[model samples]
Target: MEYMVNLEQFYGPMDLLLYLIEKNEMNIYDISIALITDQYMDYIRATEHIDLDQLGEFLVMASYLLNLKSKMLLPDPVEPSEADQESPDPREELVNKLVDYKRFKLAAELLGERLSDDYPRIFYRHGSTVLPEPESELSATPRSLHRVYVRLLQDMLAQDKYQIPQGDINVGEKMSEIEHKLKLAGRPVHFLELCHRDLGRREILALFLALLELIRLGKVTALQEKRFGEIRMVIKC
Candidate 1:
């Protein structure tokens, strides 16, 4: 009676051979080539509507198994006493190939499971239809008007363009000084108050950068009460 086997159940010839070996409770190291070859051929014959490409692979394994069986049946040649090592078994190469294939197949299955588990779920958001509010116009304050006038006067006076030699300003030192002043006052300080008349252009720039760094570090907060008004610096609560 011809046994019906599903071709889909086995990946290739080696897979079918492995299944047959395990089913018969045979040791992998000492597989019975005759029994395995017979079963392998049986499975190939039983499989229905088999693809010609896939059938060729099974036929190749069948030929190798037959060749190995023929070699095992051949007589062994006499060895000299000095070379007392036993002759290598003909099945060793095939066994190693099967072992490696089985290991790789198991690993592939594990990876497939992991890929399924880690598959990402996609979510889409709907677009909004409401119109955005119009931006309000900024009106200049009296303090802002005064600051503009002072800046213009300074620009007019700076026409002479004289270069003054000054040492590099340490932003870190300026930051420490500002933090100390804020702690001493225990209240908000005016931005202009930090800019003294004696301070050179680089010194003023350093102070501004230090203030910005403090704000970025969340150690201080800068607030303007009105548009173009004086910016006040206070310690962050």
Candidate 2:
């Protein structure tokens, strides 16, 4: 069985740090080291399901922040050391950069919100192509697992700097790929079971996207046979 996962769900540490600084309206050059560190920790704690490899630069920054906080806590030397005069605050440069980035982020988000008034979603047809709708139209389209996956893809793409051509991983192709490999191994597993295999989160997400495409095209049926654990997927008749 080929296990897959997607790692695109999370943002890097710099992006996260800028968000904290902007929300607090703090000066970039003169950050309240204590406050920013606390906020960063909150975000780290909030991201509960992080795959260690996908953690991004945030983990590095987190270590830096903690180190800075620790140094600040130590008692001053009994006598001033010569190094004290030559040394500078290690955090000064990072604070300035984060502050500048925060300004740009705020402007972009404001511009985006002002121009868009709709939400986005995907809809799968029983025997045809899945239609997509912006957030403005979700109330009219029924929600299904297929639709949920599409929206997740849409949201991820939207975070990109430029509008790249939309490319879809076909569900039918993925179904064929899975089945052939399964036949080689002689076993069948639940849809979620496939999601749990040992692969990167990003790869797993890509597989789900491909699976939805196949479902939309009437190539497969993803069904749950038991309350939990087992799932059965088969080529559609």
Candidate 3:
């Protein structure tokens, strides 16, 4: 069997960084900036006829890594100021960003796998229970309902009992639910966790559009601490 590769499967610069770190089993915080930078540049160079527009963000990240490499080579300044003493390590922020991105990326991949596995399993399983319709005022209503239900059941069994498709989602109502979640959170929450993986595609799309609308209206703010990072949504105070 021949295997095909799709470069677009990779999300962003951080994805490449995580690959490098894991490929060599290097600690995230203790990355050898020079080594990783060279490997990253080499990968970019190896891609044939790469679109610079898509590659721009990665190139920018490469420059950042190179700058950090240069900083690592320089001697610590003598007689550092009090503010400098209180400042974080130069690589601390970058490490934190990478760690966060890796976490969400892994989570997304797991969700994808679960979805794939779930789809196949759904076809084989048979539902044993039927929901009982409520009692009605007219005796004829029960008979009519039973006939309709039997007809539907026969059609489903004849058609191999596929899952019923979901109904149209109300975007406006979903937006309100998201707003309520934000209000309850009272802080930024990871966007992925808001909609949930089990939600249908239509529902997810509605939630996403709702988020964008909220952002446009300035009722909420969407932020990424770093490029190619997980988006976080905050309720505007």
Among all windows of ten consecutive residues in candidate 2, which has the lowest summed lDDT? 1-10
The better-scoring model by lDDT among 1 and 3 is: 1
Candidate achieving the largest TM-score: 1
Give the range where candidate 1 is weakest over 10 consecutive residues by summed lDDT: 121-130
Per-residue lDDT over 1-237 for candidate 1, one digit per residue giving the tens place of the 0 to 100 score: 356777667888888889999999999999999888888778777878888998898889989998988887777664676347877888999999989988998999977775574666343575343357766887899999999999999987795466455788999999998998898889999988888998998898999899999999999999999999999999886
Better of 2 and 3 by lDDT: 3
In model 2, where do residues sit more than 4 Å from their true spots?
A: 1-10, 76-78, 81-87, 96-237
All candidates: TM-score = 0.47, 0.36, 0.45
Q: Whole-model lDDT, candidate 2?
A: 0.67
Lowest-sum lDDT 10-residue window in model 3: 1-10
Best by lDDT: 1
Give lDDT: candidate 1, residue 8.
67
The superposed Cα distance between candidate 3 and the true structure at residue 166, in angstroms, equals 44
Count of backbone clashes for each model?
Answer: 0, 20, 0
* lDDT of candidates 1 onward, in order: 0.86, 0.67, 0.80
Please provide, for model 3 over 1-237, each residue's C-alpha lDDT reduced to its tens digit, 9 standing for 90 to 100.
133333345678898888888998999989888889888877776666656787888788888988888887887664666555655567887899998998898899887886674555443345533457877665668889999999999998888757676787987887788899989988888888876778877788898899889898898889998998888998887
Query: Model 3, which residues run further than 4 Å from truth?
Result: 1-9, 78-87, 118-237
